[model samples]
Target: MAKVKGEIVINSERCKGCELCVPVCQQQTIAMSDKLNSKGYHYAMSINDECNGCINCALVCPDGVISVYRVKLKDAAVA
Candidate 1:
């Protein structure tokens, strides 16, 4: 089987800095930004490219401002 990678996109402006997504990320890909959004809240940001396509962050986001994508790594494909 091919290796799967996860990509996460966060709507910073809409995020409430609730920190709900931070703990759910097993890969530690999500983090709170020091910069504040228009709402004066520290929005969530992708700290690394280690996401494994897990939707835990999105599912835990109360604002529904998180998006998750999955990519199959061709190099790890099965014969």
Candidate 2:
């Protein structure tokens, strides 16, 4: 079976620095940015490539700024 991978997109401008999604992510994929957004608030961001599309962050976000995309990669052939 192919392995699953995921990526997340966050709308920093809409984020309100709530940080609600930070601890809920099992993969530790989400983090708060040091910089502020256009709204002058810290926003959630995806820190790494280990996301599994669990949608925990998205579900927890009150502003609904997080979006997750998942894909499956086929295994490489043996040499």
Candidate 3:
């Protein structure tokens, strides 16, 4: 199985709640939160297990609020 390693950041204040990122995500990792932010808008959050670090969310974000990062995995010790 391929390992997915990355982080996503959504600027809730900048988000327009258009859900443009929701459908484009192939992994179905991105979703709109039920809780509202200070701007009274629902923001997008990612499910860790569902995301594959494909960077689709960032590409779909009109406000440029989304960010993606790839994590470096530690190598296993040689026995």
Q: List TM-scores for all candidates, in order.
A: 0.90, 0.88, 0.78
1-79, model 2: which lDDT tens digit per residue? 3277888999899999999999999889888999999889988888997898888889988989888898876566211
True-structure RMSD for candidate 1: 2.4
The TM-score between candidate 2 and the true structure equals 0.88
Error (Å) of candidate 3 at residue 74 is 6.1
Which parts of model 2 have CA positions greater than 4 angstroms off? 77-79
Backbone clash count for every predicted candidate, in the order shown: 1, 0, 0
Q: Clashing residue pairs, candidate 1?
A: 6-53
Write model 1 residue lDDT over 1-79, tens digit each, in one string. 3288889989999999999999999999999999999999999999997899879999989999999999887873523
Candidate 1 residue runs with Cα over 4 Å from true position: 76-79
* Candidates 2 and 3 compared by lDDT, better number: 2
The TM-score measured for candidate 3 stands at 0.78
TM-score of 1: 0.90
lDDT tens digits, residue span 1-79, model 3: 4354567788887887889999998778789989887888898888656566778889978889998876544444111
| Predicted model with the maximum TM-score | 1
Runs in model 3 lying further than 4 Å from the true structure = 72-79
lDDT, residue 14, candidate 2? 95
Q: Which structure among the candidates has the greatest lDDT?
A: 1
Candidate 2 CA-lDDT value: 0.87
